[model samples]
Target chain A: MRRRPGIGGLQKAAAARDQYRLLGENVAKLRTDMMKEQLATFRSQLEEFARKHKNDIRKNPAFRAQFHEMCAKIGVDPLASNKGFWAELLGIGDFYYELGVQIIEVCMLTRSHNGGLISLQELCNHLRQRRKKDREAVTEDDCLRAISKLKVLGSGFEVITIGKKKLVRSVPTELNKDHNQILELAQGQGFVTVEEVQRRLSWTSGRVTDALETLLEEGLAMIDNGHKDGKCRYWFPCVSSVYSSIGSDP
Target chain B: MASGSSIGVGVLFENAEVTTSGRPVLRRNEVECFLLSSVEFDSEDDPPRFTTLKSGNLILTTHRLIWIPSQSNGAVPSSISLAAVTHIYSHKKSIKSMFHSPRIRFQADPGAIVVTIVFRGKGDIDGFLTKFWECWRGRAWEEEEKSESETSRSGSGTVAQGLYGNDGTVRMVGLAGILRKEQEQWESTDKSLQDAFQDLNALMSKAKEMVSLAEKMRQKLLSAPSSQNGSTDDEEMGSKEEMQQWMLSVGIISPVTKESAGALYHQELSRQLADFVRIPLEQAGGMISLTDMYYHFNRARGTELISPDDLWQACTLWEKFDVPVMLRKFDSGVMVIQNKSHSDEEVMSRIRMLVTKTETLRAGVTASDAALTLKIAPAMAKEHLLTAETKGLLCRDMSPDGLRFYFNLFPEIDPTSQHIAKDFGTYGVWVKATSMLSV
Candidate 1:
């Protein structure tokens, strides 16, 4: 109560500060303890729920999805360990783990053709082909989930989107905007001439040449000097070629 | 067992089981704190006669110090419990200590043995020592033991045997007994369900028990098919598996919610994202777009979904942490999470191999062709093809047949003598492959 600036007053102020610090520490510790307790209870209850509804969660996709949502909200990773209750009861761990392996096999087998890049739809098609005998349909969502788990191997595995299409990149090669632009433009005919790119992109000839030269150098583009117009065609192999109007009248 | 002399690798310290990947198996609730590579563990005694461990990774956890050899040619994974550590001798600052490799000495129990850790590789010796001291003083093992003992004590009291008959009721016999038991069980389940649905609060509390009933019903359905006939129907089995398959994905049970993590929300979220992205990244073949990640992450999170900005902020913050996954923005402004170890050189070499093939050389591989061969998306294949093109490993050929990529014969063909057939080069190979196709 003494509002004096003497030595005794300073000592009292220091003592009060120390008490406040102690109280704050105690409150923080209490809060952490409470949170830990809540987490423990949540975990136990979630385990019980999963155990009870294992069959339903496994059979009903929508219900299973809801349960997964619940698990996520509570921060429980059912797929964290294969030897756990989740694995024994649901076998969910092995399912995704096996999917991951299948994905790797698919990527490895197709690496020679796509240069380590494949469209999600194409990947799914290959996956379906491989899993023809398998009754359970592997959705793109499931693939994404399984692929997400493979990040532990490294960052070389990733999914990138180009012009509304999701493409899975197995390698670490980067594609610039200019390169992506040219590829997008080439998506229609699977080829773009330097003049066409210059007109469409409204870029200078230098920019177009640099982009086309890069694509050509990267083995992504092939030059067709044999064209009737005499205009050199930079063909992008990554874009699906539209050969419907060409010579197919066998 | 790989080598005769190295049989004593884990003789002195307790034998620690390692994973197939050579990572030391951790005790329940035990967490790794610090890791130092290229460390040697041996006795500090003169001649180091008893035990000698060389060229191993030293991992300091909350409970033990694990030593895993780089290559398992001979050495075994070994661990010393933190409880066994009696004293950690401070580094003696002298001219002698400065010249040699950084080392740490700590006296452990059992034989009161003095263990000397020689750091042959570059690492923070002081930091390791500090963590060592902290782990030792923390006594985390004792807490685990205490909790384990308490659980065992509580569990030992209950010894309920069998179903129904143990209560000393008039046990119905054979089929009648089974029917009665089923009836009672159903009644109990019905009551529990009714109680759960009484109100939202009641449902929340009984949620755990309520969900299990569905499983019981499914199990019954499964057993019904088996009981009805000796042979199982293919359609039923397929449907059952498919139903379960819907819920087969991994769920982050304990997502880092704002309520739980507070001010460390982004940091915790970043760490969790790093862990979460591993599977998807692997599936996507080591890279995934930010948009895809957001969808997957949110889908998993269910209700407590974060905003795009939040996800972006969390990814940007990954640079400050020692996470394995990183936020990579390409020149096209497309953001992706990639492993730090992903190498473009490997992809380039694969592309080089692809284009140089006789079939590909003749026809000129398109993005789809590359996608099929490379086992990647056409978009990604295009990126690689573009990259290969930029490296001058391949050339473009565009026509009515669309775009195609061929091995860059530009470098091998002499500009002055373009028509000359050099029998050895890629040009010659291409000519040979294409001529055969034309004929």
Candidate 2:
């Protein structure tokens, strides 16, 4: 009310403006404090829900039997409310699942590609058959360890046996636990190699590599660029290495 | 890695090692004092061969003799092991011998190269002889052998105590039972040991260098008890306590004192420093503040303490060796020695979970709060929080109340639109958290 004084016009008017400004500052500080408290509450419930959902998907027997390993990236343990915990876990759940698939994908390159080849040599032939641009042969050790990780998750992917030959591919029956964002990021690129996915996402090497390794294991994606036509491709039944071939995790 | 050559009179044989800094590494517990150059050896029974060892430095220690080649070679020069000494000839003052620079001759077998040390550097030759004779008689090699056995003995005892006992037998008693028995043993042992160690005079004379040094200092301080006590107050007492603590840490049985290491002082000191850093490093979760290390290293050194500059030089030398530790200086000018394999990512993830939780988001986490979660000291926890802040994994809250940290929602929050959660980001979770707290 003290903007200016009329005894001399300026002083009374200035006094009125100062009081109005002081009142506005008090209201803004009060509002921020009140909002902060409310935000802290909602956060807890979301975190809890996300965490439990991730765990259920990880431990479910039907799913466990398909992947090598599954883990719910730690969400909230002590301080977060149960609801808040799940929300946080759910946020990153899809990425976690993708890492599992990539591990399986890398493993597939070692065995056989023709009806899942038997040995490293056959795997190399499969990559050679692709004659696709920039496709490389996969090694045995990488495939074995990645598969072994699945078992650590209390789950094992389908290592299909073709007759008596040692041919297996860990396929999660339900691969679409959560991975749309990844597919979105790919921009209809379908399943791709770790290097390609990482480049496209502009994510750190570790994060992309982890997700791609998960994608391959889910059988949602396979290394297919090697073919007689030499066109590097990731093929799926109706989707073409893109059967939404993404799973959050075991 | 070795060969048997004539090894000329001036040429050094095997059993030599040089530190990465191009300084000669010494045998365990060998402390150096006097240094000289152009030194050589000759014997009464051999041919008139003269060792043409040019420009190399000579060193005398209480334990063994040491020599180092120059940096011009781009590598450490070869040195001899004094443990191989077969005989030591007494220096004579005969007419012809007096004309030449003083040289000490000794016989070391395996090839009987009758080593001659030519002292050309400016140092007291008599002091060098005094120390050399003291070192030779000290039998440092034997002590080294004993220390190895002692280490093995302690290691095995702990393992045995886990499975059995020190009597070369497995007791297989439950830990509670063992603790009870040990408690009894300690009480009895403590009394007798205390009684035996009570003599002020005998304790002073017991060849305990650090203890005597501390005792002398303590007595001098006590003489003026109150009249001068105020002047020697808390800081004086702190230093006194530190002196006592150092004397206790020097329990290494035989420290590599300067009197024993000669020209190779800092280099040998560096290796010993490497071995010594392991315990403090472990206690500090594979890393420790350099200031902490400085205190620890000097305490371990006792009377032969080194300066901070030496500690830094030693830590910098770790990169050249296959040692499992390293020295790191944070951008904050806080220097630390960390295990090479220590992972900041693991620590960071743990802290992320800690501060982002509903309670921490509401109340925030002081260094002590992080200490509880990280299971470390508050000071160390603060360093971790600061590191996380720099990495954008966490952020700080400073006000009149206190400084604290909260998990960073930088990745989750849409900074351009703070209120919107983007349907599924960390910011969404954060918004929910504050709401839960308010309710």
Candidate 3:
């Protein structure tokens, strides 16, 4: 209120602020560098741990889960790519590649009967049966990762849900909403009657008939008219365990 | 099954019902009208002999008035059918009432006993009374009986007309009348279909009618094969069968909606979701992804779509309620709904069986392969495989082709003697399989 500060005073204050900002930035940069170095060291230690406990990691799921937890904390994704430090150290990438080829072969072999729409479980069963004498074990997780990699093929390989079951479609057949709806409804009994669908979905008979015809044409569904109820049962083979066993046997 | 002394006052009422979750069972087409918490049932007329029932939820459904004890320990829940209720006395307004909680009195039968509903917790007293009157006067029970008979008559009448229309002796209606009737039916059906596709709002309104029409057509188709057996060819039969299949898929009669359920939306939605997921869960081998569930549930609900946040909230509330299913989060942060009784051991053992095969030992199996083998979703299959890996049952193999899993041979392999194969364990078998491939 007495005498306002001059331009010289204002300039001096600005210089002090600038100096403080520079100093703060330098300190932050140094801290970041230190953290990066620490992270590098931790990553190498993790690699050593993996090498040391390779046997335990392979033989024990609980131990592997813990090891995975440790990897997560360090922001290390060992499964990100097949060709990295992990691939060289663990030889996992080559293993998945080999499995992918076998999966293609199996899919090709069963394409005729299933019309390229085979349940994942059935495929696994066939794979196991094909190599029953081998001592090495395979799990569904390994199969899934392999399939994800197969997406690059552009060959229309995909996993689709019909009800709760997953079906591996090797073809490029498109399924509309009507088809999906029918598949979902059939999940309860593995089959559905026209009356049941009509009552439940509240669709016109023509629409219901049209959807069912498409499904039948696609060979996704089978017809059963032998019941005493006199109602035709449209059975989705993808969701029916009994149908899988019966259809796959021959 | 606790002591009788802990039980509430016994009221003589007929046909009381309870659900598997210990909640009052609602009749088909019956909707809950009102709910009041901490309601006490007592008769001031018979004080000493009758013990006062306290701290229970009083629910008024379209068909009956039910009171369920808040705690299940030793309380005997009771219900009085609206049909049995003789009269409802007006709430008395006196100087003494100004200091007391809100109360309503009603006279029910079997015996002309006056039952007083004392609301110890806050609720809409007027709304409950109004609904009580409307339900009593409406006489919905009688309508149910009439509708049942009407359905049977219509069903048989249609069958008779459609199947025996060509019989020469039974020409009650002229051909012109039959043709005119058919044209009128077609026009009506066409109008409905056109209206349904006009706009979303129109479709929502016409959805119920569409469902009924679909049901009628299916009924006609069901009897078509039996009546026209001689004229039906293989191609015609095939087309007819296809038509039948389509009609079978359209269902989900009453979907739970927020507007309909109000404050209890999540709880009601959770219950309905539980019932809906049973078949799908079983088919999926006991577990399904939350994303998949969202799609199925919304599709079943039709127009009344729910947000993901609401679904998550409903799933979280399952922990508070005694439900047969549970929500699980994988290490990958992928959420899923699974049966409470679903066991991982069986799946683990199945994986164990799968990996030990000769080809899998040498080449490994991918997640899709495992999904196929386990009869589960690829995502769920991967979770199981990862769990197996963590348990040392399997080890992962990552390659350019894909990620695959093989039975753990690391434990049996002598890491120090890398080039040599131990002649006994899984490692040896794997080595043999690979060598044969090389040959």
Candidate 4:
């Protein structure tokens, strides 16, 4: 109602404020309801879409990854449950599950010589060989998803980044900052001498010695003193190309 | 990691549930106060009956003394309920007792049996006995039962059904349940809202309920399958995820408050955070930036929001506990929470495969390219690439296009015969890959 601009106006303002609060709350609630409705519809549509392109999604790794990305955005995890609608319809859960098992098999097989650290390419190569008879080709996307799921099994399986490459660590050994730095320095020649590490990393001799000794102890580093410079070369087999043949099947 | 339940049968002791990580699965509202590893639980009344449960980890909680085996054996993971304790004998100093492992003796019933706990591990025995005495005298179980009964009495009119609360309110389930509950809540909320505005004091008192109401509404939004309704449009999907994230960070039904946990606040909070992060961690691909974790954790806590310091303290406390998740600091000082068992070999292997591809081997891959290939964030992909480079899996090539990572061929270059390439080695493979690109 129209009112005078005085003490009565103050009362009117208070009433208006209360009304505004209520209106605001209602709007928020309605928005949430709308969002939920939209989500439900999207889920139904996704199921339909998956049904239409099951083969394309399964066979084409790029298409499968794009589909997975779409699922992630909508908060629909086709791999969340092995017995859910998506799993039954797409069998994507079992696909990832089987991939997870094979991943472990590969890690366990290569752990002996690589000292639990293997490159992604080597692991995928082994995996592809193992799954060669299978119809669908597995991609790095599938491996990442499968490995992410493996976190539930404890801290035994994980992916770590060093420099520009990703290393898959199968053991629970922690590579400290210093260890990582030393490893990075060795990337140039597949080996780093103690003096070379000191020159590049600018680390104190004690610190370098401690890190190198720990790496050697972990069996991650192989000592190669057969050099003309007389500098003890620490050859990291996990990082060095010389040992790429380690996990390769004869 | 212990993967499954190994609850064993015991004649004298109560078999308790252990988590996949081999820690005891605490009951509702129960908080662990202290832990002493490699402690043996033996009955003085019958030595042979309790001999099986030897050198296990003794955990003292508000309501029970859980003794989980240090290593899984035929012996069952067991506990002696503090509720059963009849009396605790005070520590005695003697020449003979000083030579042996520190032990605490307590008397308990069904048969008024004397239980002796031998502490063989390196732990503060005196401190453990103090907690044991405190837990026994606290009568926490009785207090819990009393409060539970009071809640039930208040909600006497409730008809018990699926997802029943102690107050007899039907906890909503599914879309229909949510819609029905929404109507009931709105009506009650409207009445309360009007009443709260009547006086300033009333508003202050009603603040907690207001917070809880917000929590309830957030949960409803969270429960609803809103993501399913979004079309194949990317912008809509983005907003849907954003909305879902907003909803997710709004409520934790029973946040571990400082008032509730008191001196054991951080410890309890640590355990709760450990349990809470499993879902979010899985969603984040087993690792989450600490800052993101902080927001998610605080949002889920609703009204009982914690400080950054409190979260930091809780995360740091994880190192002492056997929780499956651990806090890690990157070389750049960015902290992250990840699974304790997250092995780098798994990721490294994948990255290795990525760079060695025919085209990638020649042109090399940028962080964005790696991110696209790996299905991870570009920043995370960069971290992985850096780690791989550090490990000698790849070498960086700084070009106009930016930092591109190529498969390291230095090992295959034999310095004496640098011009020559071996057919069997990756050097030869790289030459073939690059040569094909040139042709």
lDDT of 4 by residue, A35-108 (tens): 45544554444344444445433432222333433443444332221234674455454455546645654665
Cα lDDT for residue A136, candidate 2 = 33
Please name the candidate that would achieve the greatest DockQ relative to the true structure: 1
Best candidate (score: TM-score): 3
TM-score comparison, 2 vs 3, better candidate: 3
Name model 1 segments beyond 4 Å from true.
A1-250, B1-63, B66-78, B82-108, B112-282, B285-287, B290-329, B336-375, B397-404, B414-419, B432-439
To one decimal, what is the Cα RMSD in angstroms of model 3 from the true structure? 32.0
Tell me the TM-score of model 4: 0.43
For A54-116, candidate 3 gives per-residue lDDT tens digits of 444333222233344334333332222123455435535444544454455466556544445
Please identify model 3 stretches exceeding 4 Å from their true place: A1-250, B1-11, B14-24, B45-53, B93-99, B148-262, B283-285, B295-305, B330-334, B356-369, B375-379, B391-439
**RMSD (Cα, Å) of model 2:** 33.5
Q: Which lDDT tens digits does candidate 2 get at residues B186-249?
A: 3433343344234423222322222222233334333324333245456345434433333324
Error of 4 at A92 (Å): 52
Each model's DockQ score: 0.04, 0.01, 0.01, 0.02
**Where is model 3 chain A poorest over a 10-residue stretch in terms of lDDT?**
A74-83
Is 1 or 2 the stronger prediction by lDDT? 1
Q: Worst ten-residue run, lDDT, model 2 chain B?
A: B203-212
User: Cα deviation in Å at residue B424, candidate 2?
Assistant: 6.9
Supply the DockQ value of model 3: 0.01
